[model samples]
Target: MGGGEPGLGSAEVVQQPEQADAGSPAAGRLGLEPLPYVVGEDGAKQPVPGALSIFLRSGTAAAMCLDSLAAAQPGAPPFLRIPKEKLLADIQLQGAISDFHPIKDAIRAADCDALAVRPNLDDAYGDGNNYEVACSRAAAEAWQAVEEWRRAAAAEAEAAASAAAAQAALPKSKRRRAPQPWVDQGTEAEMEAVAGPPPRPPALLVLERPLRDLVASRQRHQRAQQQQQQPPQDQGKPASTQPQQQQQQQQQQQQQRAPRLVDVDASDLWSSAQSECRPFKDPNYDTRRARREAGAQAVPRLAEKGVQV
Candidate 1:
């Protein structure tokens, strides 16, 4: 018999007693009634056919009873009874008539030995029909599965708790702050203006030229250039006296030495070198505006080509 079909056998139908014993295993203990047939058209009941029918029904009953017991509800009656008659019938139907080996095999397959009803469980001397069953193999196995599931759930919960505790115990400085709704978000340009422009890169100094010679040469060139560029304010006036010329020369030397002492000469050299070395003006000085104009021009071309702009 297949394990899924909940039907009766075709050989012979066993007749149930007119009056069943109130505490007998023939009556369900798990508040369940045996479903031996299915409802068909016109409200007629049709008998399900197969030896597997009773086996499946008995297995289902065993499962339900175990589930109730596991719930451990307060003030609930203990589950100690099982349907033995159905299990026995299933075993007999599936077992071979001759050798007792088939019956043993069927009993093992149906798990009937563990699930069958026993009358004397609470009291060995008591009538078997009025007490809990002796062996509950199916229930034991079901409870084991439930226990495993509970252990897994408990482990997961413990891991989560540990993680939360670790996070809570972290220092305030190390903890991440959530975004504040009251904080104002300004435009990128405004934010950049507030932060100020980034510092410019340091000037590159060439080491090939001797420092003394480079400085002296540059100073002389600057002095000569300044003299040529200066307007002749006293072209018709007499030349300066020897003492005055000497004093003027001393003042110019002092001005040059003062800048070198304060370390301003290097910056001066950097500025002058950069301006003299690079003279070309950039064509796309306003890059963002240029990009906008290019995009605007492309729109007309795309429209002329029958493409969406």
Candidate 2:
């Protein structure tokens, strides 16, 4: 390269005297060759002072420009460092004193616009796709909670229906509840009824028992009234009854004279009746029951004079 004009893709290089000797090659060289550098996380090697650099007017002049920027924005880093693996990773950095606009304007004024290339923000954080995924996850969780509530409600309804069905399946006698009288009905009228109408009979026997007892009692009353109204007749035998009485007395004496027993055995009757009557014997009888006791050994015949018992 010539002395007055700079070489393409070369920065001002500070040479070491030990790197060159007088007789060897590159002995009188004075120009700068761009060094290899990686810039802005592109993962590709670039020439120093190239388009990817932050200050590329001239390495000699770039130092002066950096000093001016540091004085203007003292909170910024003193040096510009290019990342090697990811683009615009600095998107997460806070409170940056020097953003791209001022740096770009400064590079343009210095006639070195190639240095201030702006990186894309979309590429910095994966185009905001991670944010979309988080929103989708939140929406899915809400829908899942709603679905769970619906299922629980449905299960409760089904259980209630099953319980109702089981109750209905029981026998009517067990499951039936007592009837509630209507409020609008005549409660006072029913209470005041001295003889309420009979309930509808489910069967005839429910009505028949009281009817039979009433008929029997009425007949007995009529018979008692008739007996009370009639006067007792004289005790002297009537002419028509005298002969019948004589004949009946004569026949009874004849039967007594030759009484023929059929099913009556005195010995068997005595033993069986004594055993059966044993329970009726009072323990206190020997001491105190003699006066009050009826004649147990001698049974008084219950037949009236002319009637069989």
Candidate 3:
């Protein structure tokens, strides 16, 4: 037909479909042994296994079998084939899966046919066998417990406060009384009661002038006698000598009696006198004074007699 295409036109491609071997290891492990086909409600032939069919019939049985399988093979995917009726019964008996509302709602939503509808006609008519009633009862019990705890705590707090106030209010000692004013009235009355009538104050005795002059004269005579008994100093001294000295001493005493100025050198006079009267070099100088004076007097006599002076 076309130029130089004789062999190309004669060569036709042959095709063959690839088939999986039933004796392969994957097939044997997966138990993919040509599942018994069944016609579904839609009139389609679907693969159905005996084990899967049994699991669908009994949820508890399916769960047990899956648990055993998972234990045997650690890396196996989880199997979920619980029957609707068993799951609903479990949900009713066990209550909500968790306290979270959203999780319960999601579970209800996902398993609507099993969980959303009432268990029986009585529950649907609101005969009080629902999850809400159980949750409400639990809440009421919790609130009651809370109120009891609060009341107990308040009572305890009040008791403690009252005890503290009582302790604070108690007097420290038994001798509690108001302070009394200091007065002699109480003391005077008490003394008068114990000692009978009060004693009279002594009368002022007015002495006559003559008796008063007589008492003065007796005092003067007694002072004169005292002066006579005292030893007298020499009176034979010249008036210019001893009398002047006495007058000078009297004047000096009178000057000393005058009020002292604050900035006086009284301490300097005492210190200077102390320095002048230094103790003798010989400690026994006072004891040896008699012998020394006697020896000196004898020396004068000996010198008069032409002995070695």
lDDT of 1 by residue, 79-178 (tens): 3344555445644765543222223333345544344322122322222212222233543343344345444444655765776677789997776553
Worst 10 residues of 3 by lDDT: 1-10
Q: On TM-score, who's better, 2 or 3?
A: 3
lDDT of each: 0.40, 0.35, 0.35
109, model 2: CA deviation in Å?
Answer: 38
lDDT winner among the candidates? Answer: 1
For each candidate, what TM-score against the reference? 0.24, 0.16, 0.18
Clashing pairs in 1: 7-48, 7-50, 7-53, 8-48, 8-50, 119-128
Alpha-carbon lDDT of model 2? 0.35
In terms of TM-score, which candidate is strongest? 1
Cα displacement (Å) at residue 277, model 3: 41
| Model 1 quality (TM-score) | 0.24
Candidate achieving higher TM-score, 1 or 2: 1
